[model samples]
Target chain A: MTRIAVDAMSGDHGAPVAVEAVMASLRAHPDLEIIVVGDADALNKEIARHRKADVGDRLTVQHAAEVVGMCESPARSLRQKKDSSMRVSINLVQQGSASACVSAGNTGALMATARFVLKTLAGIDRPAIVSPIPSRRGHTLMLDLGANAECTPEQLFQFAVMGAVLAEAVHSVDSPRVGLLNIGAEEMKGNVQIQQAGKLIGDSELNYIGFVEGDDIYIGDVDVVVCDGFVGNVALKTSEGLGKLIAQFLREEFSRNALTRTAALFAMPVLRAFRRRVDPRQYNGATFIGLQGTVIKSHGDADAVAFASAIDVARMEVEQQVPERIRTLLAHSLGE
Target chain B: MTRIAVDAMSGDHGAPVAVEAVMASLRAHPDLEIIVVGDADALNKEIARHRKADVGDRLTVQHAAEVVGMCESPARSLRQKKDSSMRVSINLVQQGSASACVSAGNTGALMATARFVLKTLAGIDRPAIVSPIPSRRGHTLMLDLGANAECTPEQLFQFAVMGAVLAEAVHSVDSPRVGLLNIGAEEMKGNVQIQQAGKLIGDSELNYIGFVEGDDIYIGDVDVVVCDGFVGNVALKTSEGLGKLIAQFLREEFSRNALTRTAALFAMPVLRAFRRRVDPRQYNGATFIGLQGTVIKSHGDADAVAFASAIDVARMEVEQQVPERIRTLLAHSLGE
Candidate 1:
């Protein structure tokens, strides 16, 4: 059985969403075991409310006295929230009781706690966030989403390595094509940092495919796109903004009058299919790569379905032994 | 009459597209005079083909012997292509024969040459590229699209001032709300540069609204969004890529089967309205702000209608006297 620890109380919706997601994930993954860490009484009540009392070993609750606020500072959370649910869940992973941990808590707190607890793997300076964004092909893995806002050229090279390993392990692609994200595709296009990183990556054994522009992120010519956390974060959030704007525009046009409303009804099926194809919830979980243990961060506002998808991602990472694979790849490629 | 010089060569489609756009703009605006600069014979042939021989002095052709290649290096273009159509068009603006100039040529070359020829306004470190992006409320003007890869705090502040001035002038808003683009909205969220830039903008006479994340760019909460050219460029190109991906997905869904094809037929009008609402062509032009003279850069692949939209932007900037207003604003705000 693949054992996973769930931080049951840190997200915007709190324990109920986490408990419901746990129930749904348990039902979906027959060989899965989940330990919900939070206020024991509230979690038990939630489990009872869901009528999941019959599950014996597959579902269990571990008491955690506190919860981390969604907006709390990472440093303060690390110092003050030692017994917090987010920390306890990660503790479960460090203690070998769980193969992985999933949290939709404060992102900064999660990264800090995960790094402090598991520590980065040998030769890894800092843990980087790697997440998949929808593209023309299946999807492309983009790294350093918001962790390590500023990075050295060597750090960018490390991110490239980690992203490539995760893409290969999760997607089962051999020698995945990696790309360095920049303002322009030409080598002479970006700033000094990007230009220098390009040289390091070019010298590596990975399947480096030169540089890629912002549009190339979705054009799906490369499987793993790498950049500093600052650029990646802005790019990701900008995409979110654009998606919302397009949806709002479509809503306005479809509701302009009775005739357009009728057209919307006729187009309902096609619209639904299109929405399903680009649904952000399906791509909810982002991994904290370079850490010694597997940690997946879900969207803080995730509902049961979205949280369940995150659990699915944690399960896959656990089965693939993502951290171990990354360590091995780093050693082999970087001769660490 | 506002006489504008149009670079009749240098775009992906070259003279034909520029000539057609000139004809369209002449028909749209009677008070507008356009000098098409390129190989005289080719431009004349295009004008004759459009049956616009009787445009009189409203539309004229200026002979230029050279055209800058779209992919040519900016430095090479500046050093070698002195008599290129792009340079000649800008020369017309500098010589007081044209109120402004528009080109769908190489962006780097355009910025380099325009800066070299027109020079930055007093108290401005670098010129920024500002363009309108669709937002919930009409649109938001964003700056530093790709002009300077790295920007100092002062440069960012200048971009904010310029963007605010353009928003007020072009959009007819008073004291437009300005924002510094950052990874997080919090004061302490971004890198050192952004953190310092926030302080600079907050202290300025302009209406600074604190830091905004990428989503706010399209949320329309702020009138002007400012960032370094690299980040801004990535955000803009990423939006373009996402737009294309969403359109491709929609097309696939609508062509899935006979039932969906019939649905698309029924929904054609609504779909067209939505497409038109978010169409990039309507927002085709980006201004080179902070320069002494007004210059507009259109997309290289722009069609006749899109090019005409760029011409409309040029006309608006000419009427608004954007560069002169920026100069006055900077003088007052920065005490230069």
Candidate 2:
């Protein structure tokens, strides 16, 4: 039985949502166990509610004296809230009490806490935030979503290797094709940073495809796309925004008049199907890779189902020993 | 009467589409005059087709012996293709033969030619690529789509002023709210460069709205969004890719089965309305700001209607003397 620690005091709604997700996931997956780490009183009440709802003893509670606020500074919060839920949850993984940890907390705080507690894998200087985005050919794994804002050419090369390893370890791409995110597909395009990174990756023995443009991320043939944190964050956020805008446009246009509304009624199935395929909620889970242990970050506002998705990703990552695989690959590639 | 030059020999299909857009825009606007620049014999044939369509003689042709190929290096092409249609069109703008020029040609070549021919406005160093993206509040103007890969804090400030002026001049936002694009909205967040830039803009006389994340670009509360070329290019390209992916998903979903096809029949009106609002073609024009003369770059794959939108944007910029306004404002802002 694999147990993953959950940061119950994280996110907007906090304990109830994460606790409920644990109960729901436990019911669905008999092999899974979740240790809820938060205020004992608050988590107990949510646990009681799940118990009354017929959830089993697979859900357990662990006390956390403090909770990191969303607006708190990551470094200061780390010092002030030593036993915060986020810190405690990551500590469980550090102590080998849990296979992994999932948190929907302040990203900066979470990254700082996890890094300090778990330490980094050998040969890995800093970890990366890797997530899957749905595309034409299936999923394209993108890394450095908001980890290190400025990455050297060597660091970007490391991210490519780690992303490819993650894709191969979990997503099962035999020779995961990697690409450098750039302004244009041509060799001479992009700034000095990207141009240098592209050259390094192109020389590497890994399945390093040359330059890939922003459009290539969704074009979906490539397996892994690596970028610096700034560019990655912008690309990810813009995609999320555009997705919502498109959905809103469809809803508004469908309700324009009685004729369209009536058609919307009949067309609900097709529209729903379309929405389901492209729904952002289904793509909620993001992994903090290159760390010593698995740490999954769910959206701060994720509901039970989305939280469950994050837990599922945690289970997958832990089972595959993604971090260990990355460490091995990095050591081999860097000859350390 | 305002005269605009069109690069008829550019893009995938070449002269015919640009020529047709001129005919359409001419019929729509009584005061607009368009000069189509391309190979004389080929352009004359396209003009003849429009003539047969009963479009007016407001359309004229200028013969050019050469064309800059899409894949040619901007610098090498600038030297070799002096008589290329792209060069000829911008030359017209420089000589006061046309108020502005619109091209659906190779972007690098267009920007290089425009810079070489029109030169930079006083107090401005490098030009930026600014374009309008439809948003919840109507439209938001975003700058540095892929102009300069890396921008200093000072350069970003310059872009902010120019974008604010454009918003005030063309978009008619009296106190246009400007936002600096970053990974997070908080002041303490982002790298040193953005942090420094944020402080500068906040202290400026313009209506700076602090920091905005990637998602905020689509939310559209800010009238203008400023970013470095690298990040902006990624955001723009990612947005474009996601849009195509969503559209493709909808088409595939709607045509999945017989039941979905019937639903599609009833939902056609709403779907069409939704398509129109988010259509890339509807938002075709991209202005090369910081230049002494107005230069618009149309999408390489733009159709007649899309090309017409670019023409409209060019007309607006030329009529408002956007370049002169930016020059004066830059000079004033710099105390030069």
Native contact recovery (fnat) for each candidate is 0.78, 0.81
Runs of candidate 1 exceeding 4 Å displacement: A51-54, A185-190, B185-190
Candidate 2 CAPRI-style tier: medium
**DockQ of the two-chain complex in candidate 1:** 0.67
Candidate 1 residue-wise lDDT, A69-88, digit = tens? 98898889899989999999
DockQ (C-alpha) of model 2?
A: 0.67
Per-residue accuracy of model 2 over B33-105 as CA lDDT, tens digit each: 8899999999898787755344466677899999888888889878999999999999999999998999988
Checking candidate 2 for backbone clashes, the offending pairs are none
Candidate 2 local Cα displacement, residue B18, angstroms: 1.5
Q: CA lDDT of B9 in candidate 1? A: 94
